[model samples]
Target: MEMSSKLLEKAVSEMAHLPGIGRRTALRLVLHLLRQPQGQTESLADALLEFRTQIRQCKECHNISDAACCEICSSPKRDRSMVCVVEDIRDVMAIENTGHYRGLYHVLGGKISPMEGMGPHDLTIGSLVSKVKEGEIRELIFALSATMEGDTTNFYIYRQLEGLPVKLSTIARGIPVGDELEYADEVTLGRSIVQRIPFEGSLKG
Candidate 1:
């Protein structure tokens, strides 16, 4: 349905394209923005533009950052010896929110999904392997989703690390099967981290 007002229609359509937003909700948001002081809306637009252009992946951990390395990677306070492997930046945020981890992270970028045609080559697994082999790393924590692809990815990484000096562990399965790490609450996520278990699976690959 084409909206009669061109500017309003454009705003609503763009908002609709964003995740979890519908045309009606977008219209409401636009109206709210319009009602605010000009400074508010203008600053918001500028900030959005800045975020789009300024953010990049961290060189070491692949987390989102405004510089070459994210705060986590550069921070001396974080524990580099314990590296946590996550599927994406959202998982990093979720874990950080829990305040349960002081270690570094390696973003796989995505999981190994054969049906979706995503594979190990498409991820940063090779970089993770290289990072682990660099030594001084004590534990490699797998904090991916509990989905089938997530399991496949975990098993694959586990096999790759066999006989390596690093110990392989995983966040507890308290996170429901099919649930993403990004959605788990801080308490649950914290508990899971505190109760992580070692990988007992035999790597087929």
Candidate 2:
């Protein structure tokens, strides 16, 4: 691509670094921002800066939050005894949108993928085990993707909590194998949560 200006080229390069965004799309976005009023661009820049600087992970669940703990974790109405385990914040958002789960969530950050060099230690699994050992969480629901990596992560955590009194469960198989929970339709996802089965049954299927 021919760059007419160094500043534009830099902006496009930065924007293109984002996931799913190519050089052409980044250029279009940069050009759109340039076409906007200076104040509009400044506001956008300020918002992004503030978000990057101010965002914090929830102390309990590790979800994104402005404070030490996320709103869901802090809410009195949430079911503290039931914890839903997900891969990341995006999965948390998807589950929340379904409005079927009222329990607190524990974001693992990512699944155990040897190809990606992401192991159990690379995630927030230790904190989750601590939460379970604390004896407050009576039920642990595996809401991760249906991929092999997701299953491995769930099984690893299940073993970590061995001999614990907590009941183990997983989202129903309504979600197709290899499909991410975040990509499933709300109705299907909600049904899966509502019809969750025992982890032992999940192992058989």
List per-candidate RMSD values in Å.
7.7, 6.7
TM-score of each predicted structure versus truth: 0.81, 0.83
- Which candidate gets the maximum lDDT versus the true structure? 2
Per-residue lDDT value at 84 in model 1: 94
The collision pairs in model 1 are none
Per-residue alpha-carbon lDDT of candidate 1 for residues 1-205, written as tens digits (9 for 90 to 100)? 5688999998899889999998889999998999899999899899999999999989999999999999999999999899999999999999999887999999999999989899999999999999889997999999998788998999999988888999888876666667999999887788777876565642211
| C-alpha positional error of residue 140 in candidate 2 after TM-score superposition, expressed in Å | 0.4
Candidate with the greatest TM-score versus the true structure? 2
Please identify model 1 stretches exceeding 4 Å from their true place. Answer: 175-205
Q: Candidate 1: minimum summed lDDT over ten consecutive residues — where? A: 196-205
Q: What is the lDDT of residue 95 in candidate 1?
A: 94
